[model samples]
Structure formats: structure tokens, C-alpha cells
Target: MIELRNVGLKYGDKEILKNVSLTVRDNTIKAILGPSGVGKSTILKLMLGLIKPNKGQVIVDGTDITNMKEASLYSIRRKMGMVFQGNALFDSLTISQNLGFFLRENMKLPEEEIERRVEEQIQFAGLEGYEDQLPESLSGGMRRRVAIGRALIFKPHMILFDEPTAGLDPVSSKKILSLISSLRHNNNLGAVIVTHIIDDVFNVADCVAVLYQGEIIFDDVTEKLHNAQHPFIRSILSDKILEL
Candidate 1:
């Protein structure tokens, strides 16, 4: 489990996260929802150790990693897998090569074993015929799938998703949501999904947390978000984020 205890981060006079506390249980999906610029993405950075909190502890499992040394942090981050906006696939590498790239660089696995895992990952993403295809050759949704496959190739303990459906049409977005749901159900992976789309919350999330001015104003099950007492959350649900 990942737990943030009264965490706070600031840049000069602006606090990016304020007394933020939440728990993401193991084998569950936690969705962070808020308007743009509310520092939703910053939470992912803090958890990944890309950034540090000014106050409070970031505890994962039984260890407090808030102030771990950089060298040690790399080992911790190795357990994390991130799927960013736009997929971030390598331009030149084919799907299998992309999935195998990190394994070859970091693990020193034998060629045949890498080949086997690569094959499994490609199939895991439901990309059977696109093993040799480069990112440019695949559709947007397919590229996202390949990115997910690459992230999961290491069998990561936790996954981070930043706007996994951004810039895609409705159909493509739905497919990505389904893929995430499938991953959570099948692999029991812990996921932190940062998104503004409430549909994503209702569709894929086990719990929803709303960021308001760098603070979590609402953190509860998705079914409770629409009825929260917070004005900010009420306004968001009432307007359907069209006002965002």
C-alpha cells in the first residue's frame, strides 16, 4: 500500500500540495480528479520520487521513502511503471524491441528469455500481429497499448497513468479505459490514475480523490463524489467539468 501522510509541497509562496493525505490500497485503482493546474500530476512525481514533499511522509508497504538517497531511490522506482500522456514510445524501435529495451539494458537477461518475455508482453497487450511494427505505424490506441505493454514487461508492482485517454476520440478513449480496467482486474496491480474526466472515475476507478487548490477536498468512492458536501466537488459534478 502507498500512503501519503499530511504531505505538503511548495514552490516559493505557492503550495502545490497542502496537507494532502490519502491511501491507495494494494491491488486497487485510485483516481485523482481535478481541474487543470490543481497539481494532480505533482502527486505522481512525488510518489515516483521525481519530486519531494516539503512536509510529511510517503510510505510504501513498510518503508518511508520520502527522504531516501537518490541511489537507493532508483531501486525503489524500478518497481514503478508509468504510462504518460501521448504514450512516449521510441520512434525507431518496434513494439517488441521497445518492450525489451529496458530489460536488455538493466537486467542482463539472455536473448532467448528476453524474447520470451517480449512475446508475452506483446500478447498481454492484445497486440498479436504488431510485434514488428514501429510506433508510427500503429494507431493511437495501439500505441497506448504498446506503451502499457512496455511498462508491464517488468511485472511492476505499481503503475502510474497520466491522462491515459487524452487527445483521443471517444472510441479510442473507451478502449484505453477498458485496457486499464483489464489490467487492474487481471494483474491486481496498484494504479494511480490522474485524470479530469469523471467518466473515467465511474468507469475504471475504485475510489476518487479531487484536488482543489493543491488540497484533496474530496476522497471517497466514485459513487459518493456526486453527492459530496464540498462546494468545489458539487460544482464539478453539477457542471460535468464542462466548466473546466
Candidate 2:
């Protein structure tokens, strides 16, 4: 489980988040919705302990990681995985290498163990035959799957996705969404998805939180999001103008 309690952040004179509180329960997907530069990604960084909150606590499992030492935070981070928006794969490395890199370099696991874990993750991502292929040689959807596999290699308790379906075609997007839903249901995984795609939220998210002007204006089950009459929420959801 992940919880942000009255979190606030500032950079010089700019405030990115103000009194933001969010909870991602086990076996659930919480989608954070907002336009660009609204600090959606900042919340993920806070949860990962990549950055500190000026006036709040980021609790994961049972530990408050907000002020944890770097050494202590490393242990906490190992329990979480982050999938970046750009698919963040190394073009020079093959799929297997990419999946096993951290386990090999950081965990110092034996070759057989690394190979076993790599193969398992590859199969889980449905990339059985693409193990030796480089990221550049695969389709966009395949590359995205590799990125997901990399995150899943360690079997983290929680995963953070930054725009998982940003540039995929409809078919690929739906496949990724289904994968996320299955991960939550089958593995009892917890996830926080930061996205501007309303359809993505409606399709896979159990809960939705709307962030506007650095504050969350709406937070509840996905079904009740449309009931919000706030201008920012209404403007973003309206299909006629399609501001988002």
C-alpha cells in the first residue's frame, strides 16, 4: 500500500503540489488525471522516495520514507518499480540483457538464476521469441511490453506507470490496459498510473484522482468521476471540445 499524507512540494517560488493526499490500496489501480505540468509525475517521484516532500509523509507498507536515509530508501525502492513514459530501454542491449541488467549488476545473482528470471519475465510479457532482439528492432507495442517486463523482473509489490499508453495504437493500448488490469487482479498488485488519457482511466482504473493547479479537486471511484461539476474536471472530460 502507498499513502501520501497532506503532501506539499515547492521549487524556489513554485509550488508543484499542495496538501495532496492519496492512497493506493493493494489489488487496486489508482489513476492520477491532469493536464501536462500539473505535477502528476512529481507524486510518483515522491512515492519512490526519489525526492522529498516539503511538508508531508510518504508512507509505503508501514515505513515513512519521506525522511529516510539514502541507504534505507534503497531497500524501500527495491520493493517498487517505475515504468517511465518513454519506454526507457537501452537500444544497445537485447531484451534478455535489459531484463536481467539490474539483477546481474545490483543483485549479483548467479547466471542461471538471472537467466531463469529473465526468461520468466519475457514469457510473462509475451515476448518469448524476442529475447535476443534489440529495442529498436521491435514494434512500439513490443517495446512497451519489454519496458513492463523490466519493471516486473523483481516482482515489486507496487508499480508506477507514467503514461503507459502514450503513443501506442488502439490495439496495443487495449492490450497494455488489459495487462495492467490482470496484474492488479491476478497478482494482487498495487499501481499508480499518471495519465492524461481519460479512456485509460475508465478502462483500467478502480479509482480516479483529478489534479488541477497543484490540488486534487476530485478523488473517488472511477464511476463517480463524471459526477464532478468542477470547471477543470468538466472541461477535461467533455468530448465536444476535447481539451485533453
| Highest-scoring model, TM-score | 2
Residue range with the least summed lDDT across 10 consecutive positions in model 2: 235-244
For candidate 2, write residues 70-180 as lDDT tens digits. 888988888988898888898899999999988887797889998999998888889988999999999988898898888888889998999898889999999899988
lDDT of each: 0.86, 0.89
Candidate 1 lDDT tens digits, 2-101: 8899999999998789999989888889999998888888898888888889999998776889999888887777788888777888899988889999
Can you give the lDDT of residue 33 in candidate 2? 91
- Assess candidate 1 and give its TM-score to the true structure: 0.93
lDDT of 1 at 195: 90
How much does each candidate deviate from the true structure in C-alpha RMSD? 1.7, 1.7
Model 1, which residues run further than 4 Å from truth? 242-244
Worst lDDT 10-window in candidate 1: 235-244
